[model samples]
Target chain A: MTLQMTVSPDFPPAYIAGWYIFNTWLQRQSGLPIHLTLYDSFAAQRAVLAQGGIDLIYANPYDAAFLVRECGFVTLAAPCNRADEVVLAGTQTGPVNTIEDLAAGTVIARTDDPDVNLMGMMLLEPAALHAGNTTAITVDSYPLVAKQLLQGHAGIGFFLEEAFDSLSALVRGQLRELVRSRISVIRHVLLAGPGVRAQQVEHLTTLLLAMDQDDRGQAVLESMNLSGWEAHSQEDTEFMIDLMDTLDTQVLPG
Target chain B: MDGYQTRIRYFDGHSRDALIREHEVPFPDGRLIVSRTDTCGIITHCNQAFVEMSGYPERELIGQPHSILRHPDMPRAAFQDLWETVQAGRKWHGHVKNLRKDGSCYWVLATVIPNVRHGRIAGYTSVRRKPARSRIHESIALYARLREAENP
Candidate 1:
């Protein structure tokens, strides 16, 4: 009967705007009872969702993977409203052309949000991702790092797309994209549980997808880039579950 | 009329409530603090006892999380284990260090239970009592170092 949604702190304001529009659409359209709760990280949200305390959750692919498979959650669909990734250069240096092109001890300032997209990028070159090394500075927000970089604190910076969009104009202008990532499918997924029936679940999805095509839904879709909802498969949900299982096992040095 | 009283915060509001609201378990020094959290460790409430024990006024505790009381003396495994057990709808009993309003500290022997609804967790509930000397000594020694590291 309740809908619990969890989203990242990165680009949260944008999604808040998107929700006001989208939730209003739902209020007018099918009268489906839906609500949202936002968070700063995927790990924190995933833990709460796993307790089976929530009815539905809006999670990233990485977190969703674990919730649907390892926990008792089931994925309904994935959304493509906000998606972009970029490697931002510091003011004193140019962006690296590739992960391999960076100097062995190249300094890269990072902002680590609570999701895997950025962490996944770091995994692409883990050795290059030490947190405390003089060459690597990990912060919680991109603009902070961008500010530090612009002030000549760090040599270079990496900004995932959402953060890249909101950086100060000064930081944005001073920095150039060293490289851009392929548009990754970062979805805001809706996952459900055993209490929800198939018919009720489909009704919610159909109403949501059809909303965009309608005049009211169209407005929300435009603002949020919420194209439509498609059925999610077990495959789409497995990767995160496997990763969480790995993280869980490796949590302590037992 | 101005006799000294054990001050506590109401879970739902800012007004101070008396510790007369009896709990299933009686705490030493009448210092019983109760909290609610969904199985994930998010806090839902902190009774008047919690405010008195924490030295934080109700305004500071309302809508804040339960782990807001997390003391460094506690091992990471304890929290990890607490999450695992409560999410499984089990109750946990242990010792804890609670930070006071002015950044001083106190100790507690605590029990935490999951709020189960329809065979699932709705939230978690916790009860605390004054910690024994043995528990306090170990935790305080551990926390002294933690606070030092955090401050230094």
Candidate 2:
């Protein structure tokens, strides 16, 4: 049986292509039939998950927690990006040295992602740096935001650590990290639908956990900006669940 | 790295003369007490805020379980819930009361997340911030009830 998997389109188009290619490799290696879908919007993805049209999913921490809480999806393994926080990057010699430094300058970011975007704003808003203001430029993706910052079009750029990690070494070398948020529960989460078999889940989890040890697997991971896959733990899942609950109850808008 | 050190410096020597007290120490705004632990919960690294607020020296805290700061008044179920929540690969947040070396107590709003590396949980991190007074009061009442339930 083919496992229907979906990835949210909140990522840049290239990363979506990377995920497709990664899943295609999984199909070849695991000897299991697999079909991958990339939803254009989170709502479309949620609709498919609600209808049980998807059996496996790769999603950000917040959406994964939501699915596990609301749709009975099982937390499997997650790609380890080695960063659990949002990051602010700028040229090493630039005047933007702190969150407050961006108060009057253009801060380029991808505000489309509620997860990272909310995190970025949470750090900046208290300092009176509003994203809605002209000081904040909403870029569409990580690479583009990095480009904007590197090209000196903006004084600073806000994105997740993985996004910064994905940049070419030359770009990273030229930029300085001004801020990094506190760690979140997990990065992206891999989850299974109720209909998936136990053995299948176990096997896939094992395959992913070991994916980085091989050269070909490492190449796939690089394209998607991941270090490796790690086993999902019960405690980590519960932590994300609690975090989501707290975020929901908070008066702050993400 | 730069901001981390700057924040750490703020809390480094603040508790030098702390004395035992029934009252809670007022937490400064915008600073977070941060600690990182191995999967087994052994402290690996911590910030200055953690060192000061926990009432333990950096040396003493380095290899100890975070429970080193667990207050006697805290309910076991609360920690159990925290452990259960985070072990499930989710972020956990709640009010926590902790003890210091001088037998003093303090309250915080804590958020904990796992550090996943090489496809396994390498460690966990807890970031504690100043909590609202009313929230602490509510937690105090709830914790008291939970403690009574545990003993009864």
Q: Which candidate has the highest TM-score of all?
A: 2
What lDDT tens digits, residue by residue, belong to model 2 across residues B25-102?
766533557777888789998878788777688999999877767766677788788888778887777788887766
10 residues in a row with least lDDT, candidate 2 chain B: B1-10
Model 1 chain B worst lDDT window (10 residues): B17-26
Residue-level lDDT tens digits of model 1 in B49-83: 77766767878776776766654344445666777
lDDT of 2: 0.70
Residue A183 Cα positional deviation in candidate 2, in Å, after optimal superposition = 1.0
User: What range of 10 consecutive residues in model 1 chain A has the weakest lDDT sum?
Assistant: A245-254
- Candidate 2, residue A171: CA error in Å? 7.8
What TM-scores do the predictions have?
A: 0.50, 0.59
Per-candidate iRMSD: 21.2, 7.1
Q: Which predicted model would earn the best lDDT?
A: 2
